[model samples]
Target: MSISNGIGNLQGLSNPVTPASATVQTGKEEQIKSSVSLAPGAVKTTPVTDQTVISSTSELLTRALSGSDVRLDKIQPLQAAIAAGTYQVSSSDLADKLITSLLK
Candidate 1:
């Protein structure tokens, strides 16, 4: 098998190099470019508008607390029904549940 040589052998290339002038454009020197709009409807996105914007962290906390407190109040009736022995539980269903618990 023949061994191949790499870019290491092509060293010291470009015998003559001439210095060239560089151009740098400043903000003021930059040209203002405009494109011809052919589309009838172009998407124009306005800045994000929050229907419900929490002004402060405390305000957000108050709003969340209000909703959670209302939901917690609903569990009171279910708790009362179970405590008053009004909640009907079948014997066979109870035995099945116990058997399921024992199997687990």
Candidate 2:
């Protein structure tokens, strides 16, 4: 077969077929309507209020801290020593505390 004849047959096959138009009847459609209404006393709503209560332990802790003395001069020296890696803990004391806690 000739190449031109084969290409022409392919071009004719590639042409799209036209689809038929759909027919619709009008002026006979039905419509639906809906609504909702509540009676005067149907839903009763009360005013909402928020309250907060502090526990006795929390109140005591707040009062204790407020009246306590914080020795910053002593604390600053210890903090500096710890930051400089010069603060040392006794191994005997640490082991004793660890064993005590473990036993408890």
Candidate 3:
């Protein structure tokens, strides 16, 4: 056995009421003007200047990242050791560094 629910009858699913278009009418012509006037003493004008001060730490970092202080010779071996799973960390050294950073 089979049943037909008339799912193809889209006319029954549509809205029966239609919306009417709205019309707006306006009668008057007016001119709008905006103006601002400041008294002589009301406004204070000072020379605008901008200044930037780099911290010593940031300057050091920038210098380091400029590739001048990078020791690729030392880093390449460390990277290779790490990739080979043979890199080792000294417990005392690691603890000392952790404490130093925490203190900072």
Candidate 4:
């Protein structure tokens, strides 16, 4: 199965290819919106109701990460250790992990 971003391009769909900006020939009120199927039983047909777009990548990431919580309880101890010059780094372990990740 193929996946599409579905925001605009519809080159290979079984459904009629309609660009998001396609104007309705008969009506001024409705514009033809495209439906993209990422996989079989993946994309469900929802009513063409509203069109909302994220302004930018940063804005999209900000909105996506907005409601997430930071674990200050864990971070505070790490910060304290670093500040007091007690934080230890295992060079061999770090090298091993870095090599393993590169292999993957």
Q: What is the number of backbone collisions in each predicted candidate, taken in the order shown?
A: 0, 0, 0, 0
Q: Summing lDDT over every window of 10 consecutive residues in candidate 4, give the lowest-scoring window.
A: 28-37
Model 2 clashes, total count: 0
Whole-model lDDT per candidate: 0.59, 0.64, 0.64, 0.71
Residue 69 lDDT in model 3?
65
For candidate 1, the per-residue lDDT at 63 reads 78
Full-model lDDT, candidate 4: 0.71
Deviating ranges (above 4 Å) for candidate 2: 1-71
Q: List the residue pairs that clash in candidate 1.
A: none
- The TM-score leader among the candidates is 3
Candidate 1 structure quality by residue, lDDT tens digits, 1-104: 96767755544554222222222335443322112222334564558866965579888888787774455577888789899989888999999999999999
Q: What is the C-alpha RMSD of each candidate to the true structure, in Å?
A: 16.6, 23.3, 24.4, 20.1
1-32 in candidate 3: lDDT tens per residue? 97879865656633332222222224322111
Q: In model 3, which range of ten residues has the least summed lDDT?
A: 28-37
Clashing pairs in 4: none
Model 4: number of backbone collisions = 0
Query: What 10-residue stretch in candidate 2 is worst by lDDT?
Result: 30-39
lDDT of 3 at 51: 97
* CA deviation > 4 Å runs, candidate 1: 1-74
- Compared with the true structure, what per-residue lDDT tens digits does model 4 show for residues 1-104? 97777766655655654555563455533433333424534665768898887679979888889966888899999999999999998999999999999999
What are the models' TM-scores? 0.28, 0.33, 0.35, 0.34
Candidate 4, residue 5: the lDDT equals: 78
